[model samples]
Target: MKILGLIVEYNPFHNGHLYHLEKSIKETNATHTIAIMSGNFLQRGEPALFDKYTRAYAAVKNGVDLVIELPTMFACQSAEIFSHGAIATLNSLNCVDSICFGSEEGDVNILKTISEILVDEPNEFKIYLKKYLDDGMLFPTARSLALFDYINKYNLLDISKEKLLDILNSSNNILGLEYIKSILKLKSNIKPYTITRVQSQYNSETIESNICSATAIRKQLKDFTNIDSISSVVPCNTFNTLKDKINNNFDPMFDDNYFEILSSIIVRDINILNTYFEVNEGIENKIYQSIFTSSSLDDLKESIKSKRYTMTKVKRTLNNILLGITKYDMNNIKNIDSIPYIRILAFNDKGREIIKNIKNNSDVNIINKFSNISFSKDDKIFKTLIDYDIKASNIYNLIYYKNNRNLLKGPMDFYISPKYVK
Candidate 1:
């Protein structure tokens, strides 16, 4: 009954991921492992290297017992919301015992302390936070400085501002803190665990042996004159999956002209740009003007970015617009605790057992077939979230068509059934 939960992207399963999985299992001494993973889009506001199903299957086959999906709307979001969505989904399951994540700051106590501070949001902390924010510092920078000052002022736990800044600088540690914060905010029973990331730096763009970052792996794939080159990093099944994909002309999908597609949609009404998530503060005009000269995604991002707007924000905003997820929609739906249903992506025997346990205990519907869904079109809240996922799937197919040389057999989401591995 000790079911360990994990939140992951697993963009394409690799040795680093495998090691984390093993370590989590060993540390927890858990009988089952469940992962809630991102769909086609990732938290970084980019498409995954492979589709969700492929990555999920890769996870279940390797070490994870089961894999569910974090829907597209939350998948392409800021770190905090992304963590919130995932943790909420796990909470809904009512069976996960503990959650484990990779972190540069491997101490769960340290991350948990940071999470508690964030959740409490002391008045002094708020004062410094607003002070830095009003001074025009980015939210992350402001929050980091505020927390550092607040902690140092109290002289709590002998933690220095320099050490706290070092913790904030590492992306994995930041994400780990968010996960802990979400658990505390929800007051959930799930315990948090951290596995120290071994060799790969968070979001590093270089590949070194098997333990390179996913960012590095994607970068390697981009420079992959030979598709087989990645075999050293990913497992045999993953290597073969990637091999067939590449050989059949669907290899390098992450690189494409999403800018034109996004622009074509954005140009329809510049004023409507503010409607999408992250398209705030009168940034619509900048986007509309940028679309005309921007020949690529990078070009458009560079054009739209300002001191206030990071490239990740620009990319995510454009992605939200293209996918038809609006700021209005998110604002209305952000408080939802129960995501209407759970979509199972892949499972093994151990995973199947957990599914049975979930069905008997949780109220959330479990969907294995798209046709079996039972929501009314009039339910704008449910429709907006679910439709975004479906649309994102279809749009990824379009991206595939643009990236690949030949015709696709079909989009995996459309044709592939939920994978059940014995």
Candidate 2:
């Protein structure tokens, strides 16, 4: 049976995501699909809008066969590390035949060329990148300039400078390139495919028709009780599942007390503000000033934003501060060469069979219960992140309606369904 791999956040599974999965399976001719999903935090350095387990359940309900947790270290990281971790997990599965993703430029060949350039890192590109960075361009802008210069110098304008610029500007295509790079770096045999996204701009904050961006959907939910405002954009099933949650007091992740905790942390630890991962000099002092002066996270971020420091990077640094993920932790996490274990979150009946097949054939640990297993140092760190996730979930629960809180008791594997096929 052919298996296809997807790396997703599924912050809230929607119609667009469903389309991607169905199209990917059809295009790849895969019999099964697996997704390595982000847990509590996402790649953009923000907490997920929904908890991982709930999102994983929604994916399985929508058609994903198996759902594995993307460790927090990689989940809240730069594109390169995010792609590396996701691809590494799929590679470790040993069953995935192809990895499919969405991109603005659906041409796989062009993506491959860009991936090769990035992976090989030629001297000319390096010199150009250094020059741009020394000129005070942010890393993303610097890299884009370097690539543009490389393409022009080599007379590769046939790739369409406009198209290349569009691809570079797109967050999805940028990540898609990283995915391809990871595949090449690992020499994985999995074929790559891209499906162009239909409708819904990536960062658009205005809800339009039935196809709306997540940003727009999120914004609509803030005022409207029901999803009637954005129902057309999501699958009927997904909309139904979320109807009650959206109508009556829906709290996005980190909506409750995130800034309060962030403020306290910033106030208490003045020295941690100086770490390398903190990035953009004097931001620590700026954060200290904003802790008492600013009213909201956005306001605090705005107070610190400068020409040299982008808002996204500043928010990410603040997140790192909130999580107590220091430069030391960042370095240690980066050095982890291999994924220590695969933590299964949820799976359908067929997914259980896939797990059994993997357990019988592969050498990696398949963790079901946290308590029954002895964890390595890397695994322990992952567990610590999970603990933080549970804390976040508990906090979210308190804000909506106090109920019997279901903290992740042990490893998710124990609670997950694991039946063998006859």
Candidate 3:
């Protein structure tokens, strides 16, 4: 039985996502699809529009066979760490045969080439990169210039520098390439595949196509009460789900309240801001200055923005601060060879069989409930952090209604018939 693995943060399950899921399975001839998804917070350092459980349920209802939560640490990090963590989780399953991701340039060779270059940074390239950084250019711009210089030095013209620069700008494709690098780094046998993204640009904020970017859809949802505006863009089921949620006055998991808490945490711990993940070269001092002056998350981000640190990077730093994840914890987690355990989020009949097979052949524990599991000291610390995240999510839920005030606990089972099977 072939199994296809996907790394996703279906902040909200939309039509484009459903299309990717179906096409990936068809192209790979896989019997089952497994997803390592972001929990409450996503890579952008923002809270997921929906909670992880709801998103998992939505995936199961659409087409996915099984879903596992990506630890908050990796889910909230940069592209490289995010890819590394997702790949590590899927590899630990010991059943995933291939990993599929969406890319603008669907050519596997180009992605592989980029991955190799990044993995083995040449001395000349490093020198150039350092020179550009020293000149006060941001890291992304410096890296792009360095890569362009490398291309010119090698007399390589088959791939345009403009094209390569575009790839570097595209965060998703860059991460997709990182996933390939990680597989090679681990000597894993998982094959790589890419599905060309359609209609929606990853970073676009306008809903122009039927397949709209999550950012555009989310922005619309904040101001409009009707789902009809995005009806053509999202899956019917997802549309209906959002409608019901709105009617019930249920706010998305990541709400303004969550950001407020994040802001408060940053302000209160201004002295220890550098202790969080990715805080370097006096970034913490900048954050302290911003927190005291800025009123909202967006304002704080703008106040602290610099040429070297992007908005996304600042948001991720805020996430670490809110979760109390220190620099030492980040180092420790990065060294983990495999996921500590598989905490099942949702599974169907085929997924159940997969779990049975895992138990028969693997030594990794499969956990379905919080009470059934005991954590080591390190694991306990991680769990406590996760619980804090959950509380943050619940606090956002409170914005909708007083009755919707409780922290979610344990793994949730969301059973639904697969479209193909049904």
TM-score to true structure, per model: 0.93, 0.87, 0.87
Residue pairs with backbone atoms closer than 3 Å in model 3 (clashes): none
lDDT of 2: 0.74
Query: Candidate 2 — worst ten consecutive residues by lDDT sum?
Result: 413-422
**CA-only RMSD, every prediction:** 2.4, 3.6, 3.9
Q: Which candidate is the best by lDDT?
A: 1
Q: Write the per-residue lDDT of candidate 1 for residues 1-422, one digit (tens) a residue.
A: 89999999997888888899999999888999999999887888877887788788888878889999887877888888888889989999998899999998788898887888889999999999999999999897899899888777877647777788898878888789888988988889999999899987877897777778878778877876576677788878777777777676665556343656777798886767787888888778888887788778778888889887887787788788888788787887766665767889999999889999999989877878776665544667667777787888887778765555255455445456788887
Q: Per-residue lDDT tens digits of candidate 3, residues 8-49?
A: 998788888998999899889999888888877788887777
Relative to the true structure, how large is the alpha-carbon lDDT of every model? 0.82, 0.74, 0.75
- Write one digit per residue (lDDT tens) for candidate 2, span 297-341: 878888888886777778777776766665766676654545667
Candidate with more favorable, higher TM-score: 1 or 3: 1
Q: Tell me the spans in candidate 3 whose CA falls farther than 4 Å from its real position.
A: 121-157, 375-403, 406-422
Error of 3 at 238 (Å): 1.7
